[model samples]
Target: MTEPKAIVSDLESFVAIAKQVIADTRDKKAIPGKLKPYLEQLIRHREWLDERFRQPNPDAFAVYTLHQEPDDSLLIMSAVFLPGQGTPVHDHAVWGLYGVMENQTEDTRYERIDDRSRPDYAELRVVDRRLVRQGEVMISYPPDQDIHRVVNTSDKPTLEIHVYGADLSKLRRRVYDPQTGRVKVIQARVPVN
Candidate 1:
């Protein structure tokens, strides 16, 4: 077996860089596209990220808030998903970049087929299902194309970092039922201190 890669020694510095990137592009129209490079930089330090945030829970997955702006312009978080753990099909309603830090995650992207204006009803169709591996990034934005579910496909814990255009924890987003076309408002779960 080969030796493990070295962990990132300065998570704070990385956070600072991420903050700067977000701050610089907060007013931009294409938030997700503009933040991709910066987010990719973080992915380059995945070994360090995984070392700092990979804590798998037995009952559920763990989400860690690495950084958040005072004005809610940006929120950076790390999430750990254990094998077989996943999220309900949900929408962020904000532009964001999700980068894999460790192992692999299977993301099933969807498209709403009916009028999303009706909160209680929604029709969705699967657009794509792909495995996002370590060092890879996924972009979400425009609300319409952001509905999806993420699942951990590996036996080991999977770690991922997300950079959002707003404080996702404070947003009341929508979770959809693909089978029944039902929709419900759900608050995004933020990490505890």
Candidate 2:
């Protein structure tokens, strides 16, 4: 599947293709894996991303909604990372696919090492660190294996695409502190969907 069967050169085309893929997958948990190849094709093409989403914010990083399914069953988004801006360790609590569109970024994945006895605290250990360059994608699976942080290692702005099984901005997800071993719930405010 290195070459696209149909050219997904625009947002609408990509969304249509994605919605079909989502519908074809019988197991809801497999949506991210099923969507990865199309997203990779989209990443390699780069024509589907908007020009406005390629710019970085001056004082902070920015996240923009590309599209969301009508039933709120899917969300596609773009994120612009300013130089040196990085996300804290967090979990999406749902399936997701992250594809790098322009430039590159770094991802740090952590593994929870503690027993699940407490709700407000977790002991974590660094499990993986890698550079996800342009045309690359990463997956976040819920319940486990979704804890990670992303950083813009480049000196200029970098753009990345995000596709989640649900509207992540409205969900109360978990945020972690490695230093204090603390956990907090946060609902992110995002650009209009």
Candidate 3:
């Protein structure tokens, strides 16, 4: 059995390491060849984050702030989703990884298509849908690929660990309405502090 303190500590450690890697990658303007193997390894650790997210939470969503660097370049956060609680279709412009710390999360991906000329709003095509069970993870690279929505699909609340390569505070992310096909800018707030 893992203690809550230990799980939180581990997340903090990994966030620190990943932050350095992100900085190095930025400086090199490329992902270093030597880091490829470990990058994959880090992806594996993302699943480990699910354990901490499994801890109890009273609210529909709870965030545990593991790290908030001085420059706000990185943020390691955890969220708990009560049954049926979730965000609308949205996208993050920075790189991020999410792991199911407890239970399963159903997610759907969408592709954006602009129809600015018609004033009819943008079109979003469903790309994929899947249930991310415990120990499963997903990674998002911004700009090109980042639009999706996640929901808790089980009787019990779900937990998730989210690591962002950049601080997401007040960032304008796109939100889409599948039913209406409307696209709008929405601010992603750090609810956990």
Give the number of the best model, judged by TM-score. 2
Q: Compared with the true structure, what per-residue lDDT tens digits does model 2 show for residues 64-113?
A: 88888888888988899888988888988888889988889999999998
In angstroms, the error of model 2 at 110 is 1.2
Which lDDT tens digits does candidate 1 get at residues 74-125? 7788888999988888888778778887789999999988865887999889
Q: Please estimate how well model 1 matches the true structure, expressed as its whole-model Cα lDDT.
A: 0.75
Per-candidate clash tally: 1, 0, 1
Model 2 spans > 4 angstroms off = 1-6, 189-193
TM-score of 2: 0.90
- Return the number of clashes found in candidate 1: 1
C-alpha local distance difference test of each model: 0.75, 0.82, 0.65
**At residue 47, what lDDT does model 2 achieve?**
63
Residue 180 lDDT, candidate 3, scale 0-100: 85
* Span of ten consecutive residues with least summed lDDT in model 3: 1-10
Candidate RMSDs in Å, in order, are 6.1, 3.0, 6.7
Arrange candidates by TM-score, descending.
2, 1, 3
